[model samples]
Target: MVLHVVIASVAALAGRSVPSMALPKKRERAAPVVSAASSAMQMQPAPINPDWIIAGEPVARMADHSKSADRAAYTALWDCTAGTFRWFFAWDETVHILEGEVHVTAEDGSVHMLRTGDVAYFKAGTWATWRVDTYVRKVAFLRRPFPAPIAFAYRLKNKLLPAKTPTL
Candidate 1:
């Protein structure tokens, strides 16, 4: 239905009439399917020393940063193996696990087991412990917290002066 509408619209815009079939002269190219692991591998993540460690041995990390916008938004591919540690998030993070298994314990002691194809979110100021049983590879999207006064001002400005959309 959408294709038909698009064909009709294109014909109208070109000042041409559409045939009953309205078949295209050329075939569309097929896009290749890319696996998450394959794409992460393409990232060429670099090994780095763990910044913080709480218990057991320190885990090894390989990370590739895809983007960092004003230190506000960050996107990365991270891989870690064999360690357990506590974290206090200063930023909000959303992670999609691509490989391995992990057990995450919240501040209140609720445990969440995550494995391949699982996703989790950690809010700013939230405390959690992560136990990587074997290994874990994930894509993370993080948003750092803004200063309270700046955040309040930005919110007030947006509320008072909403954006205007121009008419065509």
Candidate 2:
């Protein structure tokens, strides 16, 4: 059956045995870790490539908050002054606007006006034009995604052996 083949492939790729019909054992929860609040962190200047700028000078600042255990994901606070520029996404990023606004135009001509409290996602390998009339501040969650084949295998493994929920 297709299901059997999928399970076998996923298990092999994961280098572990997974019972086809059984859930995986729950992982023990680690101690809670806390980082400094965003408001308390100092932002340092992060320069934008001059060649990417299309208009007025835009000053930008950022402060890193945390990174995942695998170093594949991170969170940061960022803010930029008024300017127009082409922005490239080297990794998957989801931004939660905290102050001001920005008008983003996609390569396909789709325009998104993001303001305070708004959220937007930009995928890896994409570029967009950003126009900020005054300022924009946001919390950005970034991740480096797994490759296509590996991602497929991971999904299959999760489907075959669903993760167990830890009890409080």
Candidate 3:
């Protein structure tokens, strides 16, 4: 009778009616995946989750969901008919042609024509311009927010070259 009374009192005070769990919360389950966009949400440099989003051709910006890393990536839209204006961006990137055909011009004026299934890698500080003679797409993966002063210096060096540009 004494043990029963104590147990009942303890259960009532604890409000559990049963033993509590002592599992580790550090071993929690991973969070679910959430997409950055749809037809509804547009960004204004808005708060991003930093997962990733590449809607193929029309949208040019990459979306982030994590809000933690310097990793950036995007897929490019290529239109051979547009014959896009010559411009160069400073960064290393991986390019894989998804469809149609296009020409890429390196800083030295060298031109490489790519078709569906072709691939190319642009080194850090590699100067390039795109000439899409056909409508196509390319996937690009790039990393920024360098770690140290040396890394930043290197990225700056590649992006800002001396004016005596080379002729290919």
lDDT of 2 at 166: 94
lDDT over C-alpha atoms for residue 72 of model 1: 76
Q: Pick the candidate with the highest lDDT.
A: 2
Off by over 4 Å in 2: 1-31, 155-168
Q: Model 1's lDDT to the true fold?
A: 0.69
Q: Is candidate 1 or candidate 3 better by lDDT?
A: 1
What C-alpha lDDT values do all the predictions have? 0.69, 0.88, 0.50
| Tens-digit lDDT string for candidate 1 (1-168) | 654455455545444332345657885553343234445454443533355555566455545454442347776777777788777777899989989988999988899998999999998989888888778888888898765544555565567666789899
Q: For model 2, what is the alpha-carbon lDDT of residue 4?
A: 68
- Which of candidates 2 and 3 reaches a greater TM-score? 2
For residue 1, model 3's alpha carbon misses the true position, in angstroms, by 70
lDDT (10s digit) by residue, model 2, range 1-168? 776687566657665432355544875553368478778989999999999999999999999888876569889999999999999999999999999999999999999999999999999999999999999999999999776655787787787777999999
Candidate 3 differs from the real structure by a C-alpha RMSD in angstroms, to one decimal, of: 20.8
**Which candidate do you rate higher for lDDT, 1 or 2?**
2
lDDT, model 2, position 1: 75
